[model samples]
Target: SRSKNSNKERNLIRAFTVLDAYASKLSMPENAKEHAAYIYRKAVSKDIIRGSSIPSMMAASVFAACKQLGIPRSMNDTAKVANMSKKKLSRTYKRLVKNLELNVSSFEADYVSKISNSLSVSEKTARLAGKIIHDLKKEHLHVGKNPIGITAASLYLSAINYDEHVSIEKISKKTNISTVTIRKMIKLLRPFASKYLKSIDLSV
Candidate 1:
């Protein structure tokens, strides 16, 4: 009799195939490709995930990519697509972030765009978040305590001010930050939000 493989094993194998394909087609910064490949490998090695769930793998890989490159994608949204537990994904995500030794000081516009695509948000929204991030840097704000944390905060601020209606709970779930931190970041940005919103509006 032949032995049967588990669904998780099958998923890992399928994820590896898809990631290998993505690696072949990807055209971007050298680091992006490397990070993408790293994420693919990580997902393939996970014991609980399945081969039929390539999209979930893709989501996890993309989330890893975002962290590795210092771009932010909401954890709740990403996990929803990936079908993984927040705690499990967060641990994996942090490990990747540490291994990659990513730079949070320098903003990567391309990586931000990729994250936006992964989250299925508009380029404009991504660009807005990127711009706000850039502006925040100018203020010499100590937002770098946690790159992903700040990035999520910035995006959430942008979303709320623009009437995008993304809840703090949702953003908190994705970034693994508390709702209090999210609220604090929003409060800190209140003075600048109006100006940033106006600028974004004019640019559009």
Candidate 2:
């Protein structure tokens, strides 16, 4: 049993390392990291890791942990860290949820702060971007959408309006979200963007 324990420890360390690569800038980095390790342990207890890919298991657990923790690492971000595709990440994440019966809760991503730190933007920018997200949520336009994309788009809008000069590509790489998705959200918010910006004395 010593051998098994050792392996679990090793796997947990590996999983944490992998998650840190992508989620290093999360507002509650330690919480997400510890929760991921907890998910790995629970999965191991269920013997769900049997005959499965280790990286995939760790990746899926991390993704579920993010969702369970209400953090902002998207499946795409997890896939990028694990070097897997979005489809595969989704598949393994679903399997992890099914096998472990994890209590995955509703998506309430606290991403503006995380993205703000990642971008090294000022607090004012983060607040304005957060206001954009809040506006979208109030309008019922942000439902069923990936938070990373929306956060990136919001940050982009905030940056440009505030003369921060951050680019779409930079946001994409930092958040591990696709540029296309960010742009789509940007376009969707264009009509309503002005109101939020105007309140903050910003122009889109």
- Give the top-scoring candidate (TM-score): 2
lDDT of 1 by residue, 1-204 (tens): 123446545655676566555444432244654676566655455432343246554655666665556544456656654567776667655554455443433343644554455455565677777877677667977444455555666676666556675566776664456788767776665555567674443121
Q: Write one digit per residue (lDDT tens) for candidate 2, span 1-204.
A: 999989978876776676566556443367777888788878878888887677788788777877765556666667877788999878878888988888786433456776778889888888888777788889899877887788788888878777888888898877767788888988877666777564443332
**Which run of 10 residues does model 2 get worst, by summed lDDT?**
195-204
**Model 1 poorest ten-residue lDDT run:** 43-52
Residue 173, model 2, lDDT:
75
Per-residue error (Å), model 2, residue 148: 0.9
